[model samples]
Target: MKRIVMKFGGSSLEDGDKILHVANIIESYFKSYSLIVVVSAMGKITDELLKASERAEKGDQDYIKSFTEYIKDRHIKALKASIKREEVQKETVKSVNELCDELYKALTGVALLKELTPRARDYILSFGERLSALIVGGALIDKGLRVKVLTGGEAGIVTDSNFGEANPLMEATFYQVKERLEKLLQDNIIPLITGFIAEDQYGRITTLGRGGSDFTATLLAASLKANEVWIWTDVDGLMTSDPKLVSNAKVIKSVSYEEAMEMVMFGAKAMHPRAIEPAMLYKIPIVIRNTFNLEAKGTLITDRVQVDKDRPIKMVALVKDVGMISLVGGSMVGARGTAALAFSTLAKQGINIMMISQSVSEADISIVIKREELSKAVNSLELNMLGKGVVREINYEDDVCVLAVVGAGIKYIPGIAARVLNILAKEKVNVFMISSGSSNSLSLVIKEKDSKIALQKVHDEFELDK
Candidate 1:
């Protein structure tokens, strides 16, 4: 039998009706493939938990207790409404109660200390997904599908010790996932894995950051070498532009992995960039479908794809609150190791550079970084290469947003830049800095507040609405 992995986001499992909708989708695919369903916490549960954590951090023990009880009641109510079998329902209720107790204890500790480290936050926050997985797994079993619940770690996802933003260690993860899946398949059990949270080699709980559940599904699909991975979300699929902004933004039926990555990297909310990495490495294709509209044709991301030759730019995305820095130095121009040294300094400081441009003489280099990292980045560069004249002024600007116009067909098109600038001009938005890659991805930095307006203008210019 073919194997497939399906992941549902929090929005898809928000309430009793939503859970039933997901169950129907699962039932539709179960007979055709050995299914692994990964689910996120119910809608807004994680957010509520974060608020509870904040209350605890404020040293409000009474408020913390009340908040925790509210969360617990919500989950228990949802579970009761979703699951039908008496025994499974009883066990799930007990499990969730125990999990809530654990969370309460963690909140008490945080309240006493009034500090929430990333590690402790992850430990406390993981309960959301953990409880969801248990509830969903029990509901599925009650629906007559053989199901087993596994936490993210038990599903063979191993990450580094980074409490948040952990990356998977592939070799170990692949072997571990294979072994577990083999045993589960033999037992005729559908594995319902918790998404987002994993354990490091040292056994500390770590989260893969926001949208990490999508990353988990892609990783599992790649490791299992499955035919396809389906990411079921609230939206139908990737659209040409933000539908709210561009009223006519249409769903893209298919897009290349590169295009999808660029979109995600530049603030497209369809999927996380890390979600596509594992699938790309293993050459696994991914399908983005809407749980609400399963019959609709969604976007397919794969290694090989054909593009429309007539289109100059396929999509326009915006990343707000960007900072651009221009490093100018004549001595650095044509210098054997200047670029490497400058980059090394930033890397050591853990500063992320989003885009870069160099002059023909290499005398000046312009780079874009997130606004939040400007001070640290400027300090690092000044300390590393200031006195030697190898690096000159670090001009920083915080009021900027990067608008990326991306498409694989851009190489064959002319006047793409003219179109983008003219549109922004029409909208009366000033372009702060402009940079385009040799790979045909054009990016522009504009004032932060003008980001949405700029994106809409560019989308209008490209005729994306059609």
Candidate 2:
């Protein structure tokens, strides 16, 4: 039997009308395929939940109450409008009550203790997906489709107990999911599934990182050996550049998995960056389509993307407002564990290194990180290396832009660097740092203020709008 998975983002399932619209899409797909539907939180609920956790951790009980109540009402309105059958709505309402109450209790505990554990945080954040699945499942029931709501754990997505960014145990996950979900499919039951939330082997709720719904869908696609995974979002498709930043940005018809991953790593939000891995490994194609514009063919991403050989540059992706820290000292030359120590230290502090460049002379090494993690990364490095004479003074900047020109063709083409720099030169965007050579993508660092203008120039230079 052929199988396929469809995932809807928050924008596609924000309210009752949106939910009904998505349900119709699902209904249409279910006619021929054994369909698995994965849903994210109904618009902005996950963000609101994170805010509630932050406020609760600061010992703000009043705000916790207000936050939880607001989310509760949001779900209630969605459920009331989505499920027409009274009995189905009644059962989903009960599930919603239990989930909302559980979230409230967790928030209350965080307020009283003034601390939120990774476990508690994951548990609190899960209500969005939980309620979303139930609402979606109930709505499907109204259409006379047999449906069941499964949380990530119940669906057998086991992971390590890494609270905020849990890694799924693929072997166990595949075994458990196939054992249970395959049976449900055999019985002609559609699984209306939650997306971002998963479970550790310890039976604790753990979440895949933000934008994990797409990851969830791709994982299932790999496990089921599905023909393809469809990720429905708000945009027409993956564009050469962010249209808001570059009005002439064109929608790319197709791209390779590697190119897509590079674009996402450099902040293109095409889909979850990790979504490409499992699907690629399993040789499953991923389709990015707009739910509102269903007729549009959207973009097809495969292991091998065929394009004009002359123009291999698919997109110039931009990461704006990044910060960089350079550890410079001649005395640090020839230090063996220097790079390891610095990176491991940042790892321990949970700071992600976005990019890195080191002088061949070993006089200095600079690392770029997100602006929000700058303070923590710097403070942790300073405190840990205060006495260790591994390096010298640390100089950091808070405003930098990262531009990644992604495509496999980059490595094959000559003078790509000259062309890139020439475009930047025309835009007067000085490139302070460049990381390239034997890389699938060329990364350039520039002033944050010039990010948009620089991107437009690069896009035009590549003639990607054509």
Candidate 3:
């Protein structure tokens, strides 16, 4: 039997009904394929966990106590609704309570300490997936399937000690994961693993950052050499553009791994950008499908692209709520370490630069980052670069957005850039900064107020709806 990994996002497992729906899907595929199912926490549970952790760190014991009860009650309610077998329900609820009890203790420690270390934060946040995994496994068992639930770390995914955003040491991970999981596969047991949570070398709990579940799925696919990885989410697949912005935005039936990465970087929410790296390296194909709409063929992402002259531009992505900071100085002309210093300073502050452009004269460098990090980025730059003559003035605009056009053909096509600029110009949208790359993407910064208009204009100009 061919092995395959199926990952269901939080939205797909929102409640008891949804969990049953996912279980049914798994049942349909179980006999034909040697299956591994990775699942995220049921709807917004992670967010609630984070919020509760924050409250605990603020010494809000009352809120923490209530939130603990809320979590326990919620999971138990979902458990009762999903697992009809009394034995399964009793056992699963016991496991859920034990986890919830542990959660309460952790929150109490945070309340007493009033400090949320990265390690502690990761530990607290991990409960979401841990509890969900137990519930999901129990449901599957209730259906008479041989199910064994494991956390990402228990499944042999080992990463560095970066508590909140850990990265797997892939070489060791690939070997260890295969060695551990293949046995279960041979025994005809379904390995249901928790997504987003992994352990570091020191045996400490860590997270893979936002959308880490997708990362987990791809990593498993590459490790197991699975036939394919399927990511079941709310959306049909990667779209020509966000449907809210472009009413006629069509689902991209096929896209290259590189193009999908570009799209994700420019605000496509179908999958995390890092999730594709392992699959791409190993040449494993991934399919993004809608759990709700089974009829939709969805999107196929692979190492190769089937080029079509009619669809040169595969996607138009709009990244909103971004701020651009321009570091200007006369001494910056031909300056070697200026850009390096600026970037390093922000790195220390944990600020991620989304887009960057430099003047041809080399006198200024403009970087775009998330709007919420604007103040910290500006302060870090000012304190480090000011009075050194490296950066004379720092100007920033928080009300801006980035528009990106991505396709494998962009690198080979000549007039695509000109046509893109023309579309923005024709719409009277002021282009603040532009960055075109050989990586099959052309990005432009524009006023956030004009984001919708710009997206619609680009979508229509490319005739993506057709």
Model 3, 278-331: lDDT tens digits are: 999999999999999999989999999765676679899888888999999989
Q: Per-residue lDDT of 289-323 in model 1, one digit per residue for the tens? A: 99998678889899875556556677887777778
lDDT of each: 0.84, 0.86, 0.92
Give me the candidate number with maximum lDDT: 3
Tens-digit per-residue lDDT, 8-45, candidate 2:
99999999989988888999889899998899999988
RMSD of each: 3.2, 2.4, 1.8
TM-scores, in order shown? 0.88, 0.92, 0.95
- Candidate 2 lands at a TM-score of 0.92
Best TM-score among the predictions, by candidate number: 3
Order of quality (TM-score) = 3, 2, 1
Give per-residue lDDT, candidate 2, residue 236: 77
In model 2, how many backbone clashes occur? 0
Q: Report how far off residue 197 is in candidate 3 (Å).
A: 1.5
